[model samples]
Target: MIEVLYFAWVRERIGVPRERIETEAATVMDLINELKLREERYAWAFDDLTSLRVAVDQELSGFDAALAGVREIAFFPPMTGG
Candidate 1:
């Protein structure tokens, strides 16, 4: 199981802050596809990948990042510096 965390508007849209998901996805993009299939909320939250940023095990990563042996994944909007 991988711990999936949603932040900011993503959390609001998904109606949850985090969840443990059992998945067979081989990559982060694949995992996102699984999420989008689960509900409309997920699809809405993930609709614009360009506006989102991802992390695997607290380290920044890309959508195509491999999910092999990953224990955590986080999704949030791109951060802007003040």
Candidate 2:
């Protein structure tokens, strides 16, 4: 099982802060594809990969990052500096 966390507008669109999912995805992008197939909410939240940032196991990562042995993944809008 993987712990998926959503933050900022990603959370608002998905209507949840987090969820635990059992998946067979091999990479972060694959996981997003799976989620997008689950519901429109997920699709909407992940519609634009350019507007988002991702973390794997609490460290910043890319969509192609391998998911093997990963325990957590988070999605949020790209951070902005003041």
Candidate 3:
């Protein structure tokens, strides 16, 4: 199981801050697709991949990144610098 965390509008849309998911996905993109299939909320939250940022095991990564041995995956809007 991988811990999936949602932030900001993503959390609001998904109606949860985090969850543990059991997936057969080989990569982050695959995982996102699986979630998108689960519900409309997940579909909306992940609709625009370019507007989102992802982290695996607390380190920034791309959608194509491998999920092997990963414990956590976080999704959030892009951060702005003041």
Per-model TM-score versus the true fold: 0.97, 0.98, 0.98
lDDT of 2 by residue, 1-82 (tens): 9999999999999999999999999999999999999999999999999999999999999999999999999999999899
lDDT of each: 0.97, 0.98, 0.98
Write the candidate numbers in order of decreasing lDDT.
2, 3, 1
Off by over 4 Å in 2: none
Candidate 3: worst-modelled 10 consecutive residues by lDDT: 44-53
Q: Which digits, one per residue and each the tens of the lDDT, describe model 1 over residues 3-69? A: 9999999999999999999999999999999999999999999999999999999999999999999
lDDT of 2: 0.98
Write out the backbone clash pairs for model 3: none
Which residue ranges in model 3 land beyond 4 Å of their true spot?
Answer: none
Clashes of each: 0, 0, 0
> Candidate 3 on 1-82: residue-level lDDT in tens?
9999999999999999999999999999999999999999999999999999999999999999999999999999999999
- The model with the greater lDDT, 1 or 2, is 2
Instruction: Show model 1 residue runs off by greater than 4 Å.
Output: none
